[model samples]
Target: MSTPYRFPDYQVAGDADTTVFLLHGAYGSKDYFREEIQTLVRAGLRVVAWDAPGYGISPLPPEGLSIERLAETAACLIDREGSKTNIVLGHSMGGIITPAVYAARPDKVHGIVISATAGSFSQKSAQDQETFLAERVEPLRAGNTFRDTAGAVIDSMFAPTSRGPMVDLVREVALSTPADTFCAAITAITRYQGEPNMRNVKVPALLLAGEFDQVGRPQSMQSVQQQFMPHADFVCLPDAAHYAFAEQHALFNEQVLRFIRERVLAQA
Candidate 1:
């Protein structure tokens, strides 16, 4: 059985009826969208970005974390926000989890924005899962700290051309995460089974991929949109990687703001 959902440590901006719950990807805290929050608010959105369980100031789930629990917590947060017409903007593993939130509270979710994520790990074999987890966790277990790995991780996440202060900021925030939290999150995402929920997202969804994203490559993201969400609008940002929004903040924010204004608000 799932534990009762608890509110996570979060930051709020804007005061619109459309509350956007920002779910960060692995190794990221709610701080992930610090740069874009003001812009989103200016475009008329109530942005509520949360530090999901085991990330940032929020304590690790007492019973350990899973995408399922994360979905439950998200639903509670949505309910607390008191909006029937809100958007869920999830990045990376967050993309995998957001659909579950839509399923848990479909009535409340007006739209979903999945950025730089596969939206499923169900395609991975058991052996593949083990290998994936080992490749990430074994190093941390072997005494490599976030600082040691952040540079490489961030490097791989972004294109060479995108490297700059934003990249450094991403690395710095990732460095603050505990090795234990990283492992726990990896385990949860690899073992998650949320593909059905993802496919069943009937609401409007905006799918964004990074042109240089090796993690959530353009083709992979397109496949999800085609196979699962045929109606979703898909865009691949140029000169971007895993953190497409940050790498192309102006365009990213523009797409999201436009989507909400056109697709989401019209429905509401």
Candidate 2:
């Protein structure tokens, strides 16, 4: 049998009965969600944000990075941090992993919030997917570090109108990722087939999209919702791009809390 993956380093706050698990995107870490965590905590909800395997202080999994392995790790963490109600909130690449977590241990996940992502990376055309991987990996293979490429990549993730500390925060988080880990993540993401997992999700779901998001486009998310998760509530945050939670955090938090109260906790 293969060795077990290392449990990620995480932060937890609040004592509320409901728990929100914040899983960041490929370019993010637990540190990136600090502000959002505080907001959730203040709203009387417990929050747990983790550094995905190979990010932050978390040790890289012995098996390297794969969406399947990431889901397994996340499911284990959810079981460890059991709560009255557990809602898994994932952004971008993390969004792709959330449904797999639910599929792995549906019993552990009470609700799911998928932000700025689609049901599958396979949704992209073959050429586009290839281009996506080449653009990110070629630079690293050519000796450019994450710091050298993160700025332009992160810049593209925001709406043209977005500026200020949040933009800087995203750049800083992206820079923190080790080059090898980032490449592994990008590869895993490109190979991921999440639609089956997504279509199988029976639990309540909230799909949050950024209106101007070029990566996880609003139109694509809407199509995913209509095709796979018709029951899920879909909301597009105007003027926000890929990092809607940071770019228009107030709206993002409001919608999240509302979903929990109306869809998750209220139903309970």
Candidate 3:
């Protein structure tokens, strides 16, 4: 279990009927959702995004366990927030956690948004990822700096078309994460297995992937999407890579909010 994680910086939008819960990817802090939080708040929906244990301000887990524990931790936080219905969104590794939240407490989350992530980890790829995480430690210890380290990984996370402040912000935020914690998160993701459970999710879902994503590539996402609620909508952001949310913020935000309004909030 994770230590109690606080999201003191999350701004509540004063809206009475809707809440938006966002989870960032591995190597990301709560700050990853800064724009989404603000956008949802401004759109009159209460926003709640948190830094999971071992990332951002939250304490790291003792064993550096898998993303399953992180997903459970997030669901606990959502339960504590006192709303039984809200929109739950996750990106990348965070995307892997989204379904866990619903499975843990289906009553609390009315919808889900999974960006640039898949439910399964292929055996061969998982092994390769384990190797990469194990190997990156020396460079990280050699004063390789999160900024430079993050730069190396950025090419795999976003589309070539991604540019502007959001791109820079993603890099900075990725670098801000403690290197060990980042690696540990990756290790956990590699061993994770929860997508099969997503097949039972009853909430409305919006699945989006970038056309050129290299990390949580689009093809894997498509395979995962087929396991989602049959009624769930899936879309591809053109000219985008893995970080489609940052690559196309305006469009991403619009599609997300509109989906929530139509599928979750409107029914409520």
Assess every candidate by TM-score. 0.93, 0.96, 0.87
Instruction: Report clash pairs, candidate 2.
Output: none
Best model number under lDDT: 2
How well is each residue in 35-86 modelled by candidate 3, as lDDT tens digits? 7777777887887777777877677766775766676777777777746468
lDDT string for model 1 (34-123, tens) is 876878888777889998888898888767778888888888888887464789999988888899999988888989999988787765
Best by TM-score: 2
- Candidate 1 residue 131 Cα shift, in angstroms, is 6.8
| Residue 70 displacement in candidate 3 (angstroms) | 1.2
Task: Return the clash pairs for model 1, or none.
Answer: none
Q: Give the TM-score of candidate 1.
A: 0.93
Residue ranges of candidate 3 with Cα displaced over 4 Å: 1-14, 123-146
Score candidate 3 by TM-score against the native.
0.87
Q: Is candidate 1 or candidate 3 better by lDDT?
A: 1
lDDT scores in order: 0.82, 0.87, 0.74
